[model samples]
Target: MPEQDDAEREFDLKWADNAERKEPSARARMLAARWKENPPEPQPFRADPDPAGPRRSSWISTVIVLGSVAAIILLLGYANFRAPY
Candidate 1:
């Protein structure tokens, strides 16, 4: 074999000799190629009005969860009051 330069000595070409090579999925490769050919436009940066605060779905979820807990607590309290110790 010919002498390899220092630049090419970083990697051993025979590393793939016994190793099982993993390849990306067809869809991933297609997307990568498409991205290289025609990259998508970047979205304009904008500050969120309330990033940490509750979003619509988050508020709904919070209401549902808290409501359920409250209902259960009320039901237990009512049952305890109506029944004898």
Candidate 2:
């Protein structure tokens, strides 16, 4: 019983000492120091206008929309002015 208690006490002390330590690697600290001395500059963000002409998809989409509108108009006109049976 006494030996078990001593073992538990030693384990607890070892864990506590390990938990309090936080030592970074020598190489990591040196690199961080160098970065701080000569930090990188920020880049500018821009959305330059596209130099290419209009796309084919845009023209196709416009044609499809116009055709649909014309078909709907014709359908409505025919339904309103149909000959009597």
Candidate 3:
């Protein structure tokens, strides 16, 4: 048990020393320095125009309007021809 403990302690110390000796790589230091010196610029926000805005009447709407007018005219003609109460 004592031997195992001693070995573990030595390993831990060696690992800590190695970690302390290691320096940040050049790329990592460059990125960190760049971020510190020039932070990211804020992006401008934009809204998309409404897709349904100001559209011309489609063929379907025109056909429906014409059909409604014709139906009203037919109804009026039938009512005129009927006997008066």
Candidate 4:
């Protein structure tokens, strides 16, 4: 057998990593070709975005993030006070 390089040997256990690249699906290829011929019109990220629209509440996300940060801070403070080594 031919000798393998360091990079090849590193990924020897990961068979998928050493495997051939995957080809796009038939449908994907068809769509890509179709778009290449006649592409769709590009629109802004928010074409008709409502100003202050009835959307999902952000308080839930804010509370989760803020609570996680507070917990981390409290844990760090407790650890520092109790056993700061």
TM-score of each: 0.35, 0.33, 0.35, 0.35
Estimate the Cα RMSD of every predicted model relative to the unseen true structure. 11.0, 11.7, 16.4, 11.9
Error (Å) of candidate 1 at residue 76 is 0.3
Scored against the true structure, residue 61 in model 1 reaches a CA lDDT of 88
lDDT string for model 3 (1-85, tens) is 4456888899998888888467889999998999898987665566455555787669879999999999999999999889596
Tens digits of per-residue lDDT for model 1, 1-85: 9999865764565565546986889999999999999997775578555568545787888999999999999999999999987
Candidate 4 residue-wise lDDT, 1-85, digit = tens: 9999988977885876667886889999999999999998998887875567577679988999999999999999998899946
lDDT of 2 by residue, 23-47 (tens): 8899989989998999766645774
User: Which candidate achieves the best lDDT against the true structure?
Assistant: 4
Q: Please give the CA lDDT of all the candidate structures.
A: 0.83, 0.84, 0.84, 0.88
The clash count for each model shown is 0, 0, 0, 0
Superpose all Cα atoms of candidate 4 onto the true structure and report the RMSD in Å to 1 decimal.
11.9
Q: Which stretches in model 4 have alpha-carbon errors above 4 Å?
A: 1-56
User: What's the CA RMSD of model 2 in angstroms?
Assistant: 11.7
